[model samples]
Target: MPAAALKPKPSNEPLPTQSTAKRPVPLDTPYAPVAKRPLPPGRPREWYVTHNRRLKAMRLAIALLDSGVHQPDQARDETIRSAARLIGVHPPSETTCHMVRALMRYAR
Candidate 1:
């Protein structure tokens, strides 16, 4: 019978990792300008004027709500034009700008 032999224990040191040995590549080389979809042609003057009006109206509505005016009392669905008028914004509404009211009602 062969004599009983004592085997050595496994090493406690961490195994060599690939990330530490690999060289990193540089990413800042100048490349051809990426093809981007061209922006839509400029809009008519009337379009710009209307867009500005909508923005103004929306802002006015937000301000009115912030000011705590007509808290859930008056008709909240009033057009942006009307709300804008109430909040002193002018030349309102190419389209009927219904108020996009942001009410935060906490659940009971």
Candidate 2:
């Protein structure tokens, strides 16, 4: 027998793929975080008030849905009112109603 034939056979399996083909990023390049643009002078207060209201309503809806107290229904006004009361929001604003509806969709 020849020497090559006596030797072990080469592997038929392919080599593992790598993710290192991309070039390394330059260390000297500026990489500062994106700066937030300032809001218009008189709009900040109202913007924040509205934003906070929406956030509060979302939180309330999540809590109500998680508690399993209010089952999902397409025409359930009482559920929305209960959720509004749970979050201490009076009059159940449009934002609160929207959040409640969104929560119901997920719950169902």
Candidate 3:
């Protein structure tokens, strides 16, 4: 093979100038002033506990559904409810159950 054939093709584009180059924003730089919104009111301890429980249940349900150990249709509701109970979600609320079911359906 000829040495000329090994040479890289040259680009037609002009090199970028300092004015055209994009520089990273400095850490000390202040961004545009964003409107500050008041924080929402906090919930009760029970609410937090319930919320955590629901999240745990949702995560567990997704894992179980993805495991493929069970059919998507057969005994799905019962399985989710049982998983929730095992995960210390107590008697899972209707909303929690519904959310779990929806997640299972969507995942499949």
| Candidate maximizing lDDT | 2
Q: Write the per-residue lDDT of candidate 2 for residues 1-108, one digit (tens) a residue.
A: 889989998775545774543635443343343345654566668787777676666655665654565655532566667655655556466666776677666766
lDDT per residue for candidate 3 within 7-100, as digits (tens), equals: 9998755467535335443433322333556534687878777766667556656545544434445535566666645444466666666666
Q: How many backbone clashes does candidate 3 have?
A: 0
Candidate 1 total steric clashes: 1
Off by over 4 Å in 2: 1-43, 69-75, 103-108
Which is better, 1 or 3, measured by lDDT?
3
Model 1 lDDT, residue 25, Cα? 34
Q: How many steric clashes between backbone atoms does each model show?
A: 1, 0, 0
**Quality of model 2 by C-alpha lDDT:** 0.60
Which residue pairs in candidate 1 collide? 80-97
- lDDT of every model, 2 decimals: 0.46, 0.60, 0.57
TM-score of 3: 0.39
Candidate 3: Cα lDDT at 54: 61
Higher-lDDT candidate among 2 and 3? 2
